[model samples]
Target chain A: MRYTSFTSYDLILLAQGLGVSVALFLVTTLIGFLIGTIWAVMRFYRVPLLTPLITFLAELLKNSPVLVQLFLVFFGLPALLKINVTPVEAAVITLSGNTAAFIYVIAVAAIESIGRDQIESARVFGLSRWQILRHVVAPQAMAFAIGPLTGLLVNQLQVTSLISVIGVVDLTKIGNILNLRTLKPFIVWTVVGGLYYIAAKLIALGGARLERRLRAHTAWKGL
Target chain B: MILAPHVPFLLKGALLTAEACALALFGSLVIGLLVAALRTSSSPLLSRAAFIYVDLFRNIPFIVQLFFFFYGLPEIGIYIDAFTTGVLALSIAGGAFSSDVIRSGILAIDTGILEAAEVSGLSKPTIFRKIVMPIALRTSIRPLGSVFINLVLTSSILSTITLNELTGSAKIVASDTFRPFEVYAVLLIVYASLTYLISLAIGALHRRLNRDRMPDVA
Candidate 1:
């Protein structure tokens, strides 16, 4: 028998694939956030060499396609450095780096969105630079950033699908497998695309909730 | 030296990429303009339908959409070549994004101008073509250019469909020369510079177009 029909186990496989995709999305997002914020902090302090270098790297990353970056890490790096890289490891590294580059851009923009007068005012109150950044800038910048950050996260989620191309066996990869097995591209892709669409919507909703909370203090009240 | 021997091959691929992007750009502009018009129209039904199209296309991954079209079209007996399919896919996706940009450009138009056009007894199509489109497109030149540049970068994905674009050719060279690093690195830089040049050109075009009316923006 050719065994081409869909099995009940395929649902479990899809669930597993969704788990991998979401887990990778969360982990890479956390890593990207930390690294990106650190880069922003470095720039805030005006670190001599690192600031400019980070900016350049971020620009290079922003301009190029994520697929190229994934290929570089997955295939190029292993060959060049003589190190072994599994597909998942490569996906994590590439996705996180790409996410960090974008986050760095957004964070920098958010930070710059803070008025210089606020910092000067804090300084006049005898606060140190770090203290001013934390006490004065952080809160407002967070509020400023959440909207764009949500947009970026939704984008990055879609980007995670590309990892399938490099053999990560992600949700899209699972979809590919089932698609090949059943030879039903329409059904397979529709279900897969639907899953992705729902995930994106959830992320957008969460971001909106967060943005509302962050901006609650400034929202207008009835007279 | 690593890239020298492969320059001609890469250039051939670039020509195809350029051709595909040009066609797709033209296609996208038409779709984008129509969608923008629909979205901005007085009819709620058309606007809602247009909104759903934009949202669905924008939310879905381009590769998935490409695969859907690539695979599903044949199932429906709508056979087409990969090149045409790729162009169509790009135009559809690009239309979604460019429509949003153009829609904003349309929204940004001064109400006074529209009122004046209305008083001058211009028909809806004539008003759109004469007053609204020129102004919207002119103001939105820069963003639309970014959309086109994105179209160029996104063209790399067409390689997956067996279209011999720049990225596809680079893949062949990479495997043949056994230099994945050099090949991809050079490829990355080439794409970046190409987009950079396009942005520069867009900036010049924007300045030139807006020179007469909006000197500050120019």
Candidate 2:
């Protein structure tokens, strides 16, 4: 007899799926943030050959679909490099790289948003370039970048769902499994979508809170 | 190298992708305009309903929405083909995003224009048609272009539903020749170039439409 009835275990399965999704999202987001910030720094320093190359790579990543990028890493990389790539590994790599590309753009823009006069004043204070960046740019850029970064985070959270395609057992993959087993697409997918929606909203809320904190200094305080 | 044999097959897939995108683009624009209208309407209830629709659609991952339609619709006795399901899903999701763009466009309109139209005794529909839509759409052409380009990219996800769009056909060719790398890499470049060309065209269109406005941006 086909065991198609709804099991309480399914909730546990969903939680597990959500856990995997969030974990991967966090890990990849951290890696992407570091790599993206580094790329922005490279551009800031005007590293001749690497700067344009990084820009080009970011452009390609930004323009293409994440699904295509996933396929390239999951299927393409193993075949080309003769390496074993687990589904989770592929998801991490692809999502991180994709996230990095976007973060790089925001970082570059944030850095550029800083006026030249501020940097010149810091320079005249005899601060080195690195010191100037650390003292004069980092805080202001963080404030400027936080807003866009939140938007990107919300998007990247949704993007984490795509990892299901590469068999990462993310929320969508769990939804797929439940969908086929119970043949209840409406219930299964709705629950799955609801989970994602909540997660996205939470991220947005967190981002908004962070943005508020970052911008608190500039906020009006007049009586 | 082996891709030479599959070029014709991939082109066939590309054509299907184009067809689905075109249909979905039109569907999305219509839905987007309607939603934008509702969201901007004076009635708080209609505007709130539209807001909820946009928010719900925007927050959810699209794959979930696709599965919801693909499997849920059949259960409800709506037996549409995978292609129709894909297009419908794309339009619904794309509508949410496009509506946001159009709503922003509408909000950016000068209050003076609306007041002037009112003083000229223009009907609501007429005002929207002659004054609101033209100005809003003109200013928003660039953002709408990005939204449409996103539509094109998102259309690739339709492959998961057994619709043999570009990505779907490429998956077939990849397995057939055991050349996943070349197939997907080429697919990546094709998608990038496709969106790049789209943005370029959108840039030109934006300039053309907004020519009389800000010369700085144009």
Candidate 3:
């Protein structure tokens, strides 16, 4: 008996795929956010050598294809470094690095959005550079950056799907597998695409809510 | 174990990348222009349908759309080769993005200009072709260039559909030469350099086309 019918096991495969995707997204987002913020801070302090280098690196990362980045990490690293790397590990590293490069640019822009006069005034009031960063720049930059940061996170979530190319077995890969086995492109792809659509919408919704909350302090009050 | 001897083979892949990107660029320009017109048309139905097309394609992953065309088309008795399928997919996806850019370009036009064109009794199609398109194309050259660069990067996905484009051909050499590191590293540089050159060309084109209107553009 050839097992050609839609089986209950298919649902389990899909759930597992979604779980993989969510797990990878969360982990990469955290790592990428940290690295990107550090890069931005390196630029913020006007570190002579490192700032230019990070800018160039981030630009290179932003310009190239993410697929190429995946190849570099997943395929290139193992051969060059003489180490074993699981698909998941490669996905995490590649996605995080790519995300960080973009986030670094946004953070730099957000930091620069603050007026120099404000920093100068804060400095005159006996605020150290570190103190100004912590107490002054950080809060305002966060408020300004949150909107763009949310956009980046949503884009990064979509980007995680590219990891399926390297055999991570995310939702896209699961869709591919089910498509091949069931020979049901419409049903399999529709359900798969529908799942992705809903997830993307949820991310957008969450970002909007976060943006509203973050900007609540600046909201206009009744006279 | 080394790839020095295989430079010519890899160059062939690069040539394929160049060819596919050129063709897809032209294809996308056509789709983009049509969709942009539809989007900015007086007909609500046409505009709404165009908007939906753009939105749906933009939101979905390109790979899914690629597979849909690559696999689903054959099932429905439309037989096109992998190269054609890849080009079609890239054109469609690029069309969505380019249309967005071009639509805004059209919207940014001054109504007084359109009114003057109308006062001259120019036909709608002619006005669209002669005035609106020329202006929109000039203004949107930069965004469209980025869209085309994206199309080039996206052309990599076509490798999975069995088209031996740049990345596809690189995969073969990677396995044959057993130098995945150098191959992909080189491929990444190739793509980055390709896009950089494209953006530079776009900058020049933007300057040249808007020379008469440089004050505003600058």
| Most DockQ-accurate candidate | 2
Cα RMSD for candidates in order: 1.3, 1.0, 1.9
Least lDDT summed over 10 consecutive residues: which range in candidate 3 chain B? B1-10
In candidate 3, the residue pairs with backbone N, CA or C atoms under 3 Å apart (3 or more residues apart, or in different chains) clash, namely none
- Stretches of candidate 2 off by over 4 Å are none
lDDT of each: 0.92, 0.94, 0.87
Q: What is the TM-score of chain A in candidate 2?
A: 0.98
* Candidate 3 C-alpha lDDT tens digits along B59-149: 6778878887887788778999988888888889889889999999999999999999999999999999999999999999999988988
| Distance from true location, Cα of A151 in model 2, Å | 0.7
Q: How would you encode candidate 3's per-residue C-alpha lDDT over A9-36 as one tens digit per residue?
A: 9999999988898889999999999999
- The Cα error of candidate 3 at residue B46, in Å, is 2.2
For candidate 2, give the lDDT. 0.94
TM-score of chain A of each: 0.98, 0.98, 0.97
lDDT of 2 by residue, A2-31 (tens): 689889999999999999999999999999
Off by over 4 Å in 1: none
What TM-score should be assigned to candidate 1? 0.97
**Rank list by lDDT:** 2, 1, 3
